[model samples]
Target: MNDSLDHDITAFLDTWTLDPNQTKSCFLDLKAHLDGLDGVRCEFVSRPGITYSLRAAHANQKKRGLFAMVDVIDDDPADRWLSVCFYNELVDDPKDMGDEVPGGLLGEDAKCFDMYESDDALLAYIKERLGAACHSASCE
Candidate 1:
C-alpha cells in the first residue's frame, strides 16, 4: 500500500471500538477484495467508526468515476459488521443486493449492505457492482 493509504488504513484501525480481532480481519479481507478489482481505489473515512469509499482511478473524468463506499460498523463491538453502500442516484440495484437505508448511515443516494461473508461469491458480487459504478457514464 502507498503511504497515504497505509496511513489512512492505520487511522481507520486505530478508531475502531469493536471486536478488534474480527474487525481487523474483516477489514483486511474486504480491502483485499477491493484491491483485486480493476481500476478501483479504496480510502479510509473516519466517522462514528471506520468506513471506506471507492473510486475508479482509470476514469478520465472525475465526474464519470465511481463513488461507492464500504463501512465498518462496530455498533455492538462483539458483533461488528461491514457495509457496502452504493450511490443510488448514480447506480442501479439490479440485483437488489444491499438494504436501502437512510443516507445518514452512509451518504446521499446510498444502498448499504452489511457483508458478513468474505467468500468468493460475495466478493464477485461486490466487484460487479463496483465495476458498474466505476464504468458509469452518468456519474454526476
Candidate 2:
C-alpha cells in the first residue's frame, strides 16, 4: 500500500476497540472460509478492521498459546480480505499464571498484540519490521 494508505489504516486502528461482539463477527467470517477449523477467537485488539486469534485444536501440534499463526487471502470481487485467525495466544496454562491469579484470569503470558498485512505492498513492510519472527509477539 502507498504510504498515505498505510498511514490512514494506522490512524483508523488507533481507536479500534476489540469488543466481544466484533471478535465474534471476525471469527464467524473466518469459519465460513476455512474447513474443519475450530477454537476460533477474534478480537480488534487495537488493530485495524476486525482482528482475531485462537488455539490449535490438534492437542499435539504444539502451536501453543491463544494464537499460533495467522493467514490472509483476497476476497473475490470485494474491497475486503478474509483473515484466518488461528490459535488464541492469550491463554496461559493455569500453572503459568501469577502466584495468586485465577486460572480463568489472563496473565502476561496470555496477552498478545500483533498485526499483519493482507495487502502485498504493505505486507513487505510488515515482514521487514517483523524480521525473523512475528513482531510484537512475546511472553516470558
Candidate 3:
C-alpha cells in the first residue's frame, strides 16, 4: 500500500464505530494479509453509510483491476458486517462456502463470502481463498 492509500484506510477505520461482532478485526486481518503479498497494491473506497471497501490487485494482473475486494457492509450502522469477494475464476470454493453472485464483482461473476461475526474457521478459509486469488492474479 502507498502512503496516501494507507492514510485513507487508516482514516476510514479510525472513524468507523467498532461492532461487538469483531468484523473490524476480521477486515484488519484481511488487509494485513494482502499487505504481505508480493507486488500487491490496495486502495480504499468509502461510501459513508453504505460501504467501505478495500480493493486489491497484483502487479501482473491484467484481466481485472482488482483480484479481491473486502467490503464493510454498513446497511445497519450500529452493526456492520463483511462481504469479501473475488473473481469467480480466480479462486476455488471446494468447500462450497461462498455464494455465487452473478456479476457481483465489477460486473463479473464472483464468489462472495459474507461474515457477520468473528469465526476463526471461516476467516481461515477466506484467507486461503485470498492467497489463491492473489497467486492467480499474479500469474495473469
Instruction: Report lDDT per candidate.
Output: 0.59, 0.30, 0.93
Predictions ranked by lDDT, top down?
Answer: 3, 1, 2
Which regions of candidate 1 fall more than 4 Å away from where they truly are? 11-26, 37-39, 48-61, 64-66, 102-107, 117-120, 137-140
Candidate 2, position 48, lDDT = 31
Provide TM-scores for the models. 0.65, 0.21, 0.97
- Looking at candidate 2, what is the lDDT of residue 126? 25
lDDT of 3 by residue, 41-114 (tens): 99899998899999999999987899999999988877999999999999999999999999999999999999
Pairs that collide in candidate 1 are 88-109
lDDT tens readout by residue for model 1, 18-114: 5634545655765776676566665555555343443334334365344666666656555666677766764576777777776633455577656
Candidate 2 lowest-lDDT run of ten = 96-105
| Model 2 alpha-carbon drift over 4 Å, by segment | 1-50, 53-56, 66-78, 83-140
RMSD of each: 4.0, 14.7, 0.9
Predict model 2's lDDT versus the native. Answer: 0.30
Per-residue alpha-carbon lDDT of model 2 for 8-120, expressed as tens digits? 43553343443322333343333332223333332222233343222222222333333333322222212323333222333332222112222221332322222221344
lDDT (C-alpha) at residue 63 in model 1: 52
Q: Judging by lDDT, tell me the better candidate of 2 and 3.
A: 3
